[model samples]
Every structure is written in C-alpha cells, then in structure tokens.
Target: MLGAVGGGALLYLSFPPRTLWWLVFPAFALLGIVLHGRRARAGFGYGFLFGLGFLLPLLAWTGTFVGSLPWVVLSAFEAMFIGAAGAGIAVVSRMPAAPVWAAAVWIAGEALRGRVPFGGLPWGRVGFGQPDGPLLPLAAIGGEPLLSFAAVLAGLAVGDLVRRLVLRQGPRLLVAPALVAVLAMAAGPLAALVPATPNGGEDRTVTIAAVQGNVPRLGLDFNAQRRAVLDNHVRATEQLAADAAAGRVPRPDLVIWPENSSDIDPLRNPDAAAQIDRAARAVGVPVLVGTVLRNPDGRTTSNSSLVWEGGTGVVERNDKRRVQPFGEYMPWREFFRLFSSYVDRAGYFVPGQGAGAVDMAGVRVGIAICWEVAFDDLVADSVAAGAEVLAVPSNNATFGLSEMTYQQLAMSRIRAVEHDRPVIVATTSGVSATITRDGAVTASTRQFTPDVLVDRTELRHTTTLATRWRSAPEWVLVALGVLAVGAGIVTRRRAVRRAGRDEDG
Candidate 1:
C-alpha cells in the first residue's frame, strides 16, 4: 500500500506545472514492484490505491466549482481502470520479457478508459504528461498510445532490474532485464532523431491573431452577464485593429475568438450580429466567432464557431463536434439533478457533426473547441481533412484560478507535435497562446487579463505518421496485451495440471 501510494504521488508530480517528467519512471517502477508477484485481487487493490493517490490530487480542479462530490466519484471511477490493469499485469508477470507484457497491459487499459462511458474522459493520460519530457518527440511517430507504452515499458524494466538486484540474481539471469531497460530508455532519443517537418519550405505562412477577452468574473455564473462577455471579446478585437492601423502590430489575415465569446447567437440576435460585424470590419478580416445557436425546437443549443466576414456576415462555420458531457450538456439530467442542484445549471448543448475544419480567406483552420482538444481523433480528423493550421477555442473561466488552463495548454503543445502543425489557443480568460509547430510557445497572455496575440504562423499541409495511422497503433498494443494475458493464463493452468499428475503418480 505504501509503495502504491508513493508511486501514484510520483506520477502526479510528473504532470504539468512541473518538469519532473523523469520521475514517472520511478513512480511506475514502484507500482510494478508492488504488483509483481501479487495475487490478482491484491494487485487490483494496490493499483486502486495508486490511482487514488494520483487522481485525487490531479483532478481536484474538477470540484473547484461544483464541490468535492463529483471529483471524488470521477477519481474513484477512473481508478477502476488502473485496478484492472494491475490484475492483468499480475497475470503476465511470470512470462518471458514480463516488463514488455506489463507495459502492453497498461496501454490496453488506457485504450478502454478512453472509450467507455460517454466517449471516455482521457484527461490524465500518461502521454499527456510528457510534453516537457524527452519522450515528447515520440508523439510524432505513433501518437499518445505509443508514447505512453514507451514510458510504461521503461518503468517496468527499471522495476524488474531493481527486483533482480534485491534478490541477488546471477549475471545470466540479469541480461534480459538490463537489455530491456537500456532499449526502452534509448527509444526516446532514437525517436527524437526522426525529422519533424512542421513548417517546411513547401508549407505556406499566414499572419493570424488570437484574442483573449477577460471574462466578467470567474465561476459558472460568469455567463450570467452574457452581453458583458460578448462585448469584452469585441472590445479586444477592436483594440487589435487599432494597434494594426497605428503600425503597432501586423494586420492579421484572420482573428479567432474563444468558445462562448459570444453567448448570444448572432444569427438570432440582430444586436449580437451587428457587434460581431463591426468588430470584423474594424479588424479588416474575418473573425471566427464562437457562439451558442439555439435549435428550432428551442430545447437544445449548438456550440459553434462561425466565420463572420467583414461586410459579408457569416460565411463559413464549423460547429464544435465534441460537446462536453456534464458541463456543456448533462447526460442524465433528471437522475443527476437529484444528487446536486448544480446539475440543472448544465447547458442543453448538443454535439454537432462535421470534419471540424473551416475555410476562412483561403486558410483552412482546424477548430477544436475547449473540451474537444482533449480528444485525439478530433484533432487528427481535422488534419486528415487538409487543415493547414490548428485552432483551439476555449473558455476556461468556469474553472476559476486553477491548474486546468495550464494542463490544457500542455495538451495543445503535445498535439502540435502530434500533427506537426502550428497551434493557436484562444481562451476567454487569459493563457491564450500561439504555439509553433515544434511545440514551442511563441507568445502567451497572463491569466485573467484581456490581451491580443498577433503572430505570423506557418501552415503545414503534410500529414504526420501519427496523423495517418490514427488509433491503429493503440489497437495493436491493446491486442498484444490481451494475447499476452491469455497466454499467461494457459501457461499457468498447464503447470497446475502437470503438478497434479505428478502428485497422483
């Protein structure tokens, strides 16, 4: 139990807001040691304890607004996946190259966790924690699943080495574990050698602006001042226009507003439409305005980004495809409202269908609104559809002053490398950033402040191996894990039968 908790703590510390990414190996090593020779039930218990230690603190941000109930429930549920991983690891621990099998098991568990119960919440994924680590480059080769597998394999190898040393294993017995450790550790630097063509000469370059308009106030009720929120973004864009006219900044070809920048749908509200039109005219370019559109039934809303062209009104648009559950829209409204009144506060927003890319003034901009950026497929799909650059329009005011923004920023950086595309992150309440295709932040804004970030961004048309393969690598690793577990079970049963036959003789 102590080892499990310690391991979890180490893994949590390896995440964003900290650069201790190397600590993840030791953390996983400890977890491997705890579950190495344990029974399946004991492994599950230890894994659950490790998960609690990691997730409880890591996900504390979830309860910042709604209280601790949801946070606790979420952590507990996610931990079950880890517990199942522990059971699988234990089953395969006696197999040849056990560390490799264990690593595969971890990836299989993550694959499952990323799919079930409302398309899965993939926030605490191991690969997401490696943005600042040496393994970040691996994301370019095989996406998050492969990167995670590499990290886990390295850790498991370390644990195996430590166990062999503690048991005083002979040199002949040590060769395989040592070789695995060296190879796993070497994979990161080796993968890093792969050239990343983010903004090669063939790709085009465009000047873009991402506006961050400070919200009225922090918390869920910030939307209560709906007009105020809309006006804030307008004012910010107008200021950017003034700066451009005065030669203070380059004229951007397009401007992007974060999600929920205009709470009132401009199509339905003349005043909202006029305000956005004036801002687009002032900027002398199309403004990708994020707004909520009410359906004809008036019972549901669509969180959409519309290209409001100067003097032309709405021209091109892309509705956010990955609508967030429990926040953007409630899943089981009636049943959940019984637990907390806050459930009723959830929006009646419905997910939209599209490729998640929109053309604005000859530039194809990929859009992943707020929660959508967390999903791997959405970003990959946009790139597959020929998006030149990526834009993540987010509204983080609801979470208040928490680590949520920075954590999300890290995800964007990882995605930049994954697809080899420059990323523009426009946020409602600061931390808005323009990231280079190489996963470096060129410019960023301070929190809770109104700011405009104008920069020349390169647009790449080439698709990366990660983008091309998509989830295939993940599925392969998952299959390997299942096969390894099944083989282990068969081997164990055979051994048991042989021992019984020997006893009968």
Candidate 2:
C-alpha cells in the first residue's frame, strides 16, 4: 500500500515544474512490484490509491478557485482508468515477456481513457511527463503511446530483475530480464539515431510574434474585465510594432494572441473589432486573434482563432473542436449543479469542424487551442492536412500561478517533436514559449508577465512518422494487451482444473 502511494507521488514529481524525469522509472518500478502476482481486486485497490496520490496534487490547480469538489472528483474518476490498468497488469505479470505485455496494457488503458466520458481529459498522460526524459525521442517514432510504452517496459523490466535477484535465481534465469532491462533503457538513445531533417530541410522560414497580454487579475473574474484584457493584448502588439520599427526586434511575418485575449465578441461588437484592427495595422501583418464568438442561437459560443489582416479585418478562422467538458460546457448541467454552484460557471461552447488549420500570409498554421493539444488526433490531423507550423493559444489566467501553465508547456514541447514542426505556445498568464521542431524551448516568458516573443521558426511541410501513422500504433498496443490478458486467464484456468483433477484421483 505504501509502495503504491509512494510510486504515484514519484510519478507526479517526474512531470513539469520539476525536472525529475528519471524518477518515473522507479515510480513505475514500485508499481510493478505492488501489482505483480497479486489478485485483480488487490491490484485495483492499490492502483486507486496510487491514482489519488498522483492526480490529486497534479490537478490541484483545477480547484484553485472553484474549490476542492471538482478537482477531487476529476482525480478520482481518472484514477478509475489507472485502476483498470492495474488489474490487467496483475493478470499478465506472471506470463513470459511479462514486461512487454504489462507495458502494452498500460497504454491500452491510456488509449481508452483518452476517448470516453465526454472526449476524455488526458491531462496526466505518462508520455506528457516525459518531455524532459531520454525517452522523449520515442515520441517521434509512435507518438505518446510508444513513449509511454517504453517507459513502462523499462520500469517493469527493472521490477522483474529485482524480483529475480531476491529469489536468488541462477545466472541463466537472470540473463533474460537483465538483457531486456538494458535494451529498454537503450531504446531512447537508439531512437535518437533516427535522423531528423534539420530545419525540416528548409521548406521555408518565417518570423513569428507570440503576444502574452496578461489578465487584469487572477481567478474567474477576468471575464468581467474583458475589455481590459483586450486592451492589454493590443498594447503589447503595438509595442512589438514599435520595437520592430526601432530595429530592436525583427518584424514578424505573422502574430498570435493567447486564447481569450479578446473575450468580447469581436464579431458583434464594432468597438472590439476596431481594437483588433488597430493592432493588426500597427504590426503590418496578420494577427491570429483568439476570441469568443457568439453563435446565432444566442446561447452557444465558438472559441475561435480568427485571422485578422491589416486591411481585410477577419479573413479566415479556425474554431476549437475539442471544447472542454465541464469547463467549456457542462455535461448533465442540472444534475451537476445540485452538487456545486460552480457547475453553472462552465461555458456553453460548441465544437467546430475543420482541419484546425488556417492560412496566414502563405503560411499554414495549425491551431490546437489550449486543451486540444492534450489529444493525439487533433494535433496530428492538423499537420496531416498540411499545417506548416503549430500554435497553441491558451488562457491560463484562471488557474493563477499554478503548475498548470508549465504542464501545458510540456505538452507543447512533446507535440513539437511528435509532428516535426515548431510549436508556438502563447498564453494569457504566461510561460509562453517557442519550441523548435526538436522539442527545445528557444525562447520563453515568465508567468503573469505581459511580454512578446519574436523568433524565426521553420515552416515544415514534412510530417514525422507519428503524424503519418496516427492512432495505429496505439491500437496495435491495445490488441497485444488484450491477447496477453486472454492467454493469462486461460493458463490460470488450466492450472486450476488440473489441480481439481488430481484431487479427484
């Protein structure tokens, strides 16, 4: 029981806002030890405890203003997925090539968790925690699923090696587990050998300006100061234009504002549209303005990124398709409201349909609008549809000084490597970054600061293996897990029946 909780905590430490990426191996090693040779029920219990220990702290930001109810409920619900994975791990732990099977089962759980219960909140995925790890290169091979599988495979191998040592196993018995452990650890470096096209082989390069116009104040009240937020972004963009004129910074080919930078319905409000137009003319380039547009229904809203050119005003737009549930729109609203008034605070956001890409000055920029980056398909599809670069415009003001911003930054880094495109993360409360195609943060701003980052990034049309394969690797891992679990169950049943026959004789 202590092992499970401790392991989960270690796993939490492995993520961003901390650099203990290597700790994930021991974290999973402990988990493997606890679940090995245990009954399915026992495994589930330990896994739940592990989940609480890990997610409660990691997701504490979710309750920074709304209070503990939502955070606790979310953590507990996500833990159920881990608990299910635990039971599968226990079933397959005693089989041959157990580490491989166990790793596959873990990914199968992640795959399922990412798809259900209102498009599934995949916030704490294991691969997201590996942005700073050696295994990060594996993301290019098979995306997050393969990276996660490699992490678990290495950890489980360590657990098996330790188990063999304790039993005083002979050299022959020890050789296989020891070899697997070494090979698993080496997978990262070996994957690093895969030649990445430098500068995406120079398809094109463009200077981008990511503007971070901070909110008036932290918490849910920022919406009330919507006009102030819009002014802040305009002020920052105009500052960038002045800097460019003075030869202090390079003039950007295109600019991006964080999500909710203009919460006011710029489409309906002439004043809001005028404010955005002023900034676009000042910068002398198109501005990707993240704003909320009221739908014709008068009740629904579209969280969209509109392309505002100097003279054209709003020329193109990409609406966020993965509108977050419970945050963007409440699910079972009346029922959830019975528990807390905060449920009503959720937005009535509607999902949009498109490739999630828009053309700006001949550059095709993929839009992952905040939470959309956490998913695999959304980002992949954008690149597959010919996005030359990616932008993740997010609003982290409500969370306020929490690790949430940094966590999201890590996801952006991973996505950069996965799709082999530079990722520009522009956030309202800061930690905005420019990640190279290699997943390195070349430039970043501090939290709660109004700043502008101007960097030249490669616009690559070439897609990585992760982009081409999509979810095929994940499904293959899931199939392997199912087959392994089935084999384990059958083997156990045969052993039981033979023992009963012996008793009868």
Candidate 3:
C-alpha cells in the first residue's frame, strides 16, 4: 500500500513546472510492486490509493480560487481511471509478455479517461510530463498515446526484470523483460530519425507576436474588470507598434492574445469593439482577439477567437469547441448548486462550431484556446484543416502562480513536436512562450507580468505522422490492451476449471 502511494507521488513529480521526468520510471516501478500478483479488487484499492496520491496534488490548482471541493471531486474522479487501469494490470500480471499487456492497459485507461463524463479532462497525461525527457522524439512518430505507452512499458519492464532477478526465476523468464526493455530504449533513437524542421527550413517564416497584457487583479473577479483587461491589451499592442516603428523589434504579421483577453462581449459592446479595433490598427496586422460573444438567447455565451484586421475589423472566427465543463459552464447546474455557492458563478457558455482554425494574415493559424490544448483531437483537427502554425491562447490568471501554466506550456511543446509545427502560447497573466517544431522553447515571459514575445515562426504545410494518423495510435493501443485482458481472463478460467476437476477426481 505504501508502495502504491509512493509510486503515485513519483509519477506526479515527473510533471512540469519541474523537470524530474525520469522519476516516472521508478514511480510506475513502485506501482508494479504493489499491483503484481494481486486480485482485481485488491489491485483496484491500491490503484485508487495511487490515484489519490498523484491526482490530488497534480490537480490542486483547480481549486485554488474555487475552493477545495471542486478540486477534490475532480481529482477523485480522474483517479478512478487510474484505479481501473490497475485492475486491468493485475489481471494480466502473470501473462506472457506481461509488460506489454500492462502498458497497453494503461493506455486504455487514459483513452477512456480522455472521453467520458463531460468530454473528459485530458490534463495530467503521462506524455505531457515528457517534454524534457528522452522519449520526446516519440511524439513525432505517434503522438502522446505512444509516448505514454513507452514510458509505462519501460517502467513496468524494469520492475518485472527486478522481480524476476530477486526471485531467482529461471533465465528463461528474463528474456521477455530484457527484450522488451531493449526494444523500448531503441524506440527513442528510432523516433529521432523522424524528420523535424525546427526552424521552418525552406518553408515560409512569419514574424508572430504573443502579447500578455496581464489582468488588473487575480482570481475569478479578474474578468469583472473587463474594461481594464481590454485596455491593458490595447496598451501592449500600441507598445509593440511603437517598438516596430523604432526598429526595436520586427513588426509581426499576426498577433495572438490570450483567451478571455476581452470577456466583455466585444461583438455586442460597441465600446469594446472600438478598443480592439484600435489595437489591431496600431499593430498594422491582424490580431487574434479572444473574446466572449453573447448568444441571442441571452442565456449562453460563446468563447471565440475572432480575427480582427485594421481595416476589415472582424474577418474570421473560431469558437472554442471544447469548453471547460465546470468553469465555463456547469453540468446539472441545479444539482451542483446545492454543493457550492460558486456553481452559479459558472458561465452559461455553449460550444462553438468550426474547424478550430482561422485565416490570419494569409496564414491559417490553429487555435486551441486555454484547456482545449489538453485534448489531442482539437489541435489535430485544426492542423488537418490547414493550419500552418499553432497558437494556444490561454488565460491562467484565475489559477495565479500555480503550476498549471507551466504544465500547459509543456503540452504545447509536445504538440509542437507531435505535429512538426511551430507553436505560440499567449497567456493573459504570463508564461507566454514560442516553441519550435522540435519542442524547444525559443522565447518566454514571466508570470503575472505584462510582456510580449516576438519571434520568427516557421509555417509548415507538411504534416508529421502523428498529425496524419490522429487518434489511430491511441485506438490501436487500446484494442490490444482489451484483447490482452480477454486472453488473461480466459487463461485464468481454464486454470480454475482444471483445478476443480482434479479436486473432484
């Protein structure tokens, strides 16, 4: 039991705002120690403990302002997915090539976790932690699912190797673990062979700027000062324009703003529109303005990114399709309102419809506003629709100095590599950064500070294998895991029947 909890802690440590990614090996190794040879029920108990140990701390930021209930409830829910994986691992622990089956089972759990109970929260995925690890290259070949599988597979294989050696199991048993360990290590070098044009080599390069016009205050109340927030962005863009005029920096072809940079329904509010229009004209380029649009029904709002050009004003728009469940809008509002007064504070926002990409300055830019980047499909679909570069416009001011921003930045970095496209992350409060196609952070800004990051961004029309395959890798891994579990169940039943016959005889 201690091992299970400790293992979970180790896995959590591997995530960013810290770079102890290698800890993932020992973490899952410890989990293997607790789960191996256990019954499904026992495995579930241990897995639940592991989940609590891991997710409680990882998701602590969720409740920073809203209080502990939502955070605890969300973490508890996500942990159950890990617990399910543990049960599956236990069932297949004694099977041939157990490490393979165990890793596949883990992926199956993640796939399920990313899809259910409100389109799922795909944050805290193991692959998101590997932006600084050696296995990062694998993302180019197979995306996050494959990267996660490799991490678990290597760890479990190590655990299996250790167990066999300690038990002095015959040399024959060592072959499977040793072979798997070797293959897993080889995957890194093999993945590196995949082509990555980090600097857009020979491709069209555009000057892109990410503006972080910080909020006047932190917490949920920050959006209340909508005018102040809008002015801050306007002031920052005017500053960028001045810089360009003074030859301090290159003028950007397109500028990106963080989500909720304008919460004041700019389309409906004439004053807000004027402010945004002023910023766009000053920059002399199309500005991707993140704003809220009130629906005609007056009950729901749309979180959208509208392309604002100097003369044209509003050109193209992409409404956020994957809205944050509780924060953006409440589910079973009346039922949840009974638990917390904050329930009503949740917006009545509806999901927007689009390809998740929009034209900005003759370039098709992919937009994954805030939490949308956490999901695989949202970003991929945008790239598939013809986005040459990716942008993540996020508002992390609500979390305030939490690791959430850093963790999210890590996801963008992984996406950069996964799709082989340059990624620009613009946040309302800070930690804004530009990532190259190889997952390297070229430039960044500090949190809670108003700043701007101007960089030469490469636009690539070519897609990586991961982008082309989309969710295929995840589904394939899940299918194999299900098959492995079935085989294990059949094997166990046959053994039980043979034992009963012998006893009767």
lDDT of each: 0.89, 0.91, 0.91
Pairs that clash in candidate 3: none
Q: What TM-score would every model get versus the actual structure?
A: 0.97, 0.98, 0.98
Off by over 4 Å in 2: 196-202
Candidate 3 residue-pair clash tally: 0
- In lDDT terms, how accurate is model 3? 0.91
TM-score of 1: 0.97
lDDT by residue for model 2 over 435-503, one digit each (tens)? 998899999999988999999997766656787789999999999998998898898889889999999
Query: Per-residue lDDT of 174-229 in model 1, one digit per residue for the tens?
Result: 88988998887788788878875543436677999999988989998989999998
* Candidate number with the higher lDDT (1 or 3): 3
